[model samples]
Target: MWAVSAKRESPPVPEPLAPLIDAHTHLDACGAETAADVTAIVDRAAAVGVQAVVTIADDLDAARWAARAADWDPRVYAAVALHPTRADALDDAAKAELEVLAARPRVVAVGETGMDMYWPGKLADCADPAVQREAFAWHIDLAKRVGKPLMIHNRDADDEVLDVLAAEGAPESVIFHCFSSDAAMARTCAANGWMVSLSGTVSFRNAHALREAAAVVPAELLLVETDAPFLTPHPFRGAPNESYCLPYTVRALADLLDRPAAELAEITTTNALRTYGIG
Candidate 1:
């Protein structure tokens, strides 16, 4: 099992909402390391009407785990890719293996991949911006080849992400998972037929910009996630987020976007199924 803090406590249950899908998450990072752990987590998520979750892989080991988790539970699907922060490690061997995993059954998408400038030089193991760009291009190609949606992760590199997608031509379906950019960029995504997936960050009191971004995104182009074990929604911001806490984020989006929670839930679920082609 991955090392985790002893004090890591899961979030309390919230009232169930209409069924929805968590477009992006990391089951391993959330401390669910075994088949039973996976089932328990999914069970918790089910309690809150989170019918399905697309757990993402940030590295090869995690990719392997993600693929297994998908097989272990029908509600789980995998999106495998070398995260931009770790893009420097994608050598020939890594690429070959990732290509094989990307095509695995239940490995429905190629991503949690894109440009991130927040970590390089600042954190150990973080890839340089140039390396990240190169990997992003490759991942875009892999997504296209696999005939799956490209789930992107952008952090402090919004313009660059769009540029890469435009230059190489984005996949048939592109999802900006955990979209945290401004209204202008959100509009740009909508115009280009890309998806804008909101996370708990949109509900943060200081995240007014994200709220505005959500406001401008057309309903059909919208999605939601916890980006769990990280961006827990308000009132539970500092807690260990599981898919069970997703209701908070969904409710926040419904209120911010001026739609009823149930209605928004059905819409987002439909979009998720359509976006990822999940059964």
Candidate 2:
């Protein structure tokens, strides 16, 4: 019989890369299937060039954990709100709790919240057009009140999302995280002065449209993120993603923009800082 060692294994260490920001991430969900796994996941993110991450919460409990994590780790920033897929879960108590969390210094944005009908689950019935509109309005107002930019997540509902933003009036600095839309949508977003954050999907071979979209987006309006522990880039698509793997995604974006990876990194880093109001 083989004997197992008593020592615990350390998390995977990430290789150093040029400084970058994960404009959108769920640090609270990174290996956070249990309480003991949260800290290690964040530590791994910091080990890489993910200088700062806007950690989003889908509910009050996740928001509370995100707030605590941000307070403990200088590199972690919090974004408190109900994700669109979980829009029905946002009870009055949750909204009240988020209002308080939003005031915390480490809370930078109010999202990972928007519309998604492609694979709507529990929210299929509750997160209808009306619910999404209401939630979007509330979150937009919260962002304005707190003086933070809005981070959005739009999947298969771009028209509705754009219409809502235009109608309700979002802040000047709105970020479309993991923007996997077409060139026309990209052009519209750029024209409206919104930032489009690219993710691993941009690297997929079948994402030519996304690549075309990236190519035309102005440098000042482009940002990159791993959406880690979810949209892992190619060459490691099947593996669990982390911020350290951002270089692969960045490289792909660079190729799309016809610029050197270093230059693209600098441009996107600056854009992210500007969009998120980070120093």
Query: Using lDDT as the measure, which candidate wins?
Result: 1
- Quote model 2's TM-score: 0.88
Off by over 4 Å in 2: 1-15, 32-43, 46-48, 121-126
Write model 1 residue lDDT over 116-140, tens digit each, in one string: 9777777887888889999999999
**For model 2, what is the alpha-carbon lDDT of residue 9?**
34
**C-alpha lDDT of residue 248 in model 2:** 78
Off by over 4 Å in 1: 1-9
Worst 10 residues of 2 by lDDT: 1-10
Per-prediction CA RMSD (Å): 2.1, 5.5
- Model 1 clash tally? 0
Cα deviation of 145, candidate 1, in Å: 0.5
